[model samples]
Target: MPRFYIAQPLAIGQLVSLPEAVAHHIQVLRLAQGELVTLFNGEGGEYGATLSDIGKRHVSVEIKTHQPREVELPFGITLAQALPEASKMDWIIEKAIELGVSGVQPLAAQRCVVRLSAERAEKKMAHWQGIIASASEQSGRNRLAQLAPLQDYKQWITQQDMHRRIILTPRAEQSLADWARHQSPQAVTLVIGPEGGLSDAEENLAIQHGALPLAMGPRILRTETAGLSAVAVLSGLWGGM
Candidate 1:
C-alpha cells in the first residue's frame, strides 16, 4: 500500500481530497477506486483509507480505520550540521530521517563552501522540507522531523540546551562510543562541520558552550557522512536502532 503525508485532520468515515501534488502522485501510480492506501497527518498515528474517487486532477479517499502505531525512537536526536556543497545536505536530511532524527539545524560555518543568500536559503529550506516529508512517508514515521531555520555558527552554538551535545572532530580525545556510554539516552544533539571541518576557534567555542568533542573513529568522515554515522552509532548504542 502507498503511504502519503496529508497534512490534514483525518477521522473515520471522513471523505477528504488530497492536495494537488499527492493527487498527481496517486494518479501517476494508477490507483483505482477502492484501493487501499495509508495516510498520515504528522499528528500521531496513520489512517487506513480507500480510494473513493479519482478525477483528472483530484483524488479523494474515505478513511476506513486508524492505526495507533508509532515508529519513533525512544530518545530524540537532533543533527546540527554546517551547510555542505549542493545536494549533499538533501541526502543527509533523507538518511537522517531514516535513522530517526527528531530535528535538523543548518548552520553557516567558516569552512562551508556553499553560501546561500537569504532568498536562496529560504528556497533551499522549502526543498529540504519536501525531502524530509517524503523521507518520513517512506520511513513510516508518523511525526515529521522539525526543520530549524538556518542560523549562524556562533549564534546557534551559544543557545543549545540538549541533555547531551557532541561535536564531531577528528582530533577529539574521546571516542563517540566512550561518550555514548555516559549519556542517559535522552535527547542528543550532534554537530557536524562542512568540507574542511570546523576551524579551531569554532571548535573551541563549541567546547566552551557545553558541547563535547567526539571522535567517530580513526578515519575522518566527510561532512555528510559524519553526522549520519554518529546518529546510527548513538541509536544503536542507546537502543533507538
Candidate 2:
C-alpha cells in the first residue's frame, strides 16, 4: 500500500485532502479512486483510507480505520551530529531516520567544514526534513523524526539534558559496553564529530556536561558512519531493533 505523511489529525471516516506534494505523487503514480492507501499523521499512528477523489490540484481520501500502532524505540535516541559536508549530512539524516532516531541536532564543532548562517540553517534544516520524511515513508515509520535547529558545539552541549549522553571518541578508554553496564537511562544522546572529529577542548566540554566519552572500537569511523553504528548498537541493546 502507498504510504503518505499528513500534517493534520486523522480520524476515522473523515475526508481529508492530501498535501500538494503528495497530490502530485498520487497523480503521477496513477492511484485511482477507490484504491486503498495508508496515511500517517506524524503522531505515531497510521490510518487506512481509500482514495475518494482526485482533484485538479489535490487528492482526497476517506479514512476508514486507524491502525493504532507506533514503531518507536523503547529509549529515545537523539543524534547530536557535527555538521559535515553538504551531501554527507543529507545521507546521515536519511539513514538516521531509518534507524529510528527520535531527533537529530546539527552541531557546528571546531573541525566542522560546513557553516550555516541563521537563514541558511533554516533552509538546510527544511531540506534535511524533507529527506527525513521520504526516509520515513520508505522505512515504514509512521512518526516523523524531529530535526532540531542548528547549534554550535558549546550551545548544543549546554542545551542537552538527556539521562545518558555519550560522545564518540576513538581514544576514550571506556567502550560503549562499559558505559551501558550500570546506567539505564530513559533517553540517550549520542554525539558524533565531523570529518576531522572533535577537538580536545570540545571533548572535554562535553564531558563536563555529563556526556561520557565512549569508544566504538579501536578504528576510527567517518562522521556519517559513527552515528548509525551507535544508533544500531543502542537500539539493539534497548530492544528496539
Candidate 3:
C-alpha cells in the first residue's frame, strides 16, 4: 500500500486533502477514487483511507479506519554525531533513521572538516529533515525522527540530560556490553566523532557530563557507521528491532 505522511493530526471520519507534494505523487501514481492508501501523522498512529475525489489541483482522502500503532524503537537512542563531509552526513542521517534512532545531533568537533554558517546550517538541517521523513515513510515508521540543529561539542555537552550518556572511544576499557550489564535506562545518548574523532579534552568534558566511554569492538568504525551500529545493537538488546 502507498504511504503518505501528514504533518497535521488525523481524526476519524474526517476528510483531508493531500498536501501539494503528496498530491503530485498521488497523481503520478494514477490512483483513482476509492483506492486504498495509508496515512500517518508522525505521531505513532496510522490511518487506512480511500481516495474520495481526485481533482485537477487537489486529491481528497476520506478516513476509513484509524489504527493506533506504536512503532518506536524499544529504547530511545540519541546520536550526537560529529560533523563529517558533505554527502557523508546525509548518508548517516538516512541510515540512522532506518536503524531506528530517536534523534540525531550534528556536532562540530575539534577535527571536523566541514563548517556550516548559520544559513548553511539551516539549509542543511532542512535537507537532512527531508531525508529523515522519507526514510521514515519507507521504513514504515509513523513517528518521524528528530534532527537537531548543529552544535559544537562543548555546547552540546552542557545541554544534554539523559539516563545513559556515552562516548565511543577505542582506548576505553569499558564496552557497551560492559556498561549495560546491570542497568537499563529509558534513554541513551551516544556521541561519535568526526574524521579525526573527538579530542582528549572533549572526551574528558563528555566524561565530566556523565558520558561513559564505550568501546564498540576491537576494530574502530568510521564516524558514519558507529551510530547506526550502536542503534542496531541497542535496539536488539532492548527488543526493539
Best by TM-score: 1
Q: After superposing candidate 1, which stretches have Cα over 4 Å from the reference? A: none
Give TM-scores for every candidate, taking all chains together and pairing residue i with residue i.
0.98, 0.95, 0.94
Write down the worst ten-residue block by lDDT for model 2: 177-186
Model 3 sits at a Cα RMSD from the real structure of 1.5
Give each prediction's root-mean-square deviation over alpha carbons.
0.9, 1.5, 1.5
Identify the superior model by TM-score, candidate 1 or candidate 2.
Answer: 1
**Full-model lDDT for every candidate:** 0.93, 0.88, 0.87
Candidate 1: residue 4 Cα off by (Å): 0.2
- What is the lDDT, from 0 to 100, of the residue 33 in candidate 1? 94
Better candidate number, 1 or 2, judged by lDDT: 1
Best by lDDT: 1
Ten-residue stretch with the least lDDT total in model 3: 177-186
lDDT of 3: 0.87
Q: Runs in model 2 with CA error above 4 Å?
A: 181-185
